[model samples]
Target: MIKVIIIGSGNVAQHLIAAFQDSQNLGSEIELVQVFSRQTTNLSHLLDYDKITDDWNTLAEADLYIIAVSDDAIADVSSQLPFKNRLVVHTSGSVSLNALDDNNRKGVFYPLQTFSKNKAVDFKTIPICLESENATDFQLLDKVAKAISDKVSAINSEQRKALHVAAVFVNNFVNHLYEIGSEICQEHQVPFEILKPLIAETADKIMVLTPEEAQTGPAKRNDTATIEAHEAFLSNENYLTIYKTLTQSIQHNGKKL
Candidate 1:
């Protein structure tokens, strides 16, 4: 079995711990040897107390060490590792492969999806982006990625950076819009639940149709009257700015905003 150790107990780290444990339960050739977290309470529910470590000196040897901490902490965490030459990787979409300390073999095992501690995700459907300096380490990363996900891709630093930007647009930014819509609904005494179907259908349509082909709105029709009404109705300057910006982009046929 390929022995693995994970560092951190944040959202990404917890999700990874669950996915790896699930894979092991299914008889996959992978074993989660241990996990390192500053506060054991954060992960005590997910893993046995014996398997979670708070001290760096007690870290066991493993074939792979996954640093799933925040982006800023990756280098510091890597530098503090007790071992060397092991395949050490970070679960960051924007951070470079070289962010890890030079004492270890660096790689990236970035899962391209937003993670929330309360939200369960199917790793099988999430795309895992792998990057490494050498072919041998990349092969190992690929195997580990495929062990959990059906969609695995060899993404280099530059491409991964671009993908992260696009992900922010599609996932993070879009979610903000949803939050705005929800707030608007609540403010107007409209049930936010009523918009759930529309949201579902909009998301489902993109699965088979191109985003451009699926696009529909007053903006798409260049309905200036509706656009003006929406802009006028939105008393919040931030909302009004975003509405006008998006409308202009749509009317301009996907012009960069």
Candidate 2:
């Protein structure tokens, strides 16, 4: 069996563990030998497992070491590992594969999704970005990735970096827009619940249509009167600025109804 050790107790680590457990392909071929964390209390959910550890020494026994810690601490944790030829990998999108200097055979297994401890992920649909130093390692990582996800892609470090930035725009910036809409509803004494359907529809449409094609609203339609009214209704300067900026972006991008 291929022994695997994961380092971290955060949402990513938890999600990864859950994914591994769900993968039938890896059930008999691979085993999760250890889960390392600084504070064991954070990993109470995994207490049933006999392989949980708060110390780095436990990592010595595993054949594959996965540093799922934060981007800043990947190198720190990797450098301390005792095994010289052990295959080491990290689950990060922004951090490059070369970040871990202890081993030259490092790779990245980035899951392109926002993970929260309370929220479960559908690994089957989520994209798994796999990369490694050479063809042999890349093939190994690809096999591991395909076992957990149907949408696995062999993306290099530079492409992975670009995708990470794109993810921030689509996920982070779009969520901020939802927040702004909620705040607007709250301030106007309107139920924020009313916007839920619209938000869901917006996301749903994108699954079947391009964001540019799904674009709607006064800006895309060039309804200046409605745009002016929306700007006038805004009580917060920041909110109005955001609205104006997005409107301009949509209009300048030549989005048509």
Measured by lDDT, the strongest candidate is 1
TM-score of every model versus the real structure: 0.96, 0.93
Residues 1-257 of candidate 2: C-alpha lDDT, one tens digit per residue? 66677888888888877777666344645667678888777777764556688766655476567789999999888888766766789999999888986554688889999987677779888899988777887777777777778999989999999999999998999899889889888878999999999989998999999988888789988999999999899879998888899899889888433
RMSD of 1: 1.7
Whole-structure CA lDDT of model 1: 0.92
Q: Considering every candidate listed, which one attains the maximal TM-score?
A: 1
Kindly list the per-residue Cα lDDT of model 1 for residues 1-257, writing each as its tens digit: 88899999999999999999999999999899999999889998999999999999899889899999999999999999987788999999989998889999999999999888778999999999998889999988888888899999999999999999999999999899999999999989999999999999999999999998898889988888998999999999899999989888888874543
Worst 10 residues of 2 by lDDT: 21-30
lDDT of each: 0.92, 0.82
- Candidate 2, 94: how far from true, in Å? 0.7
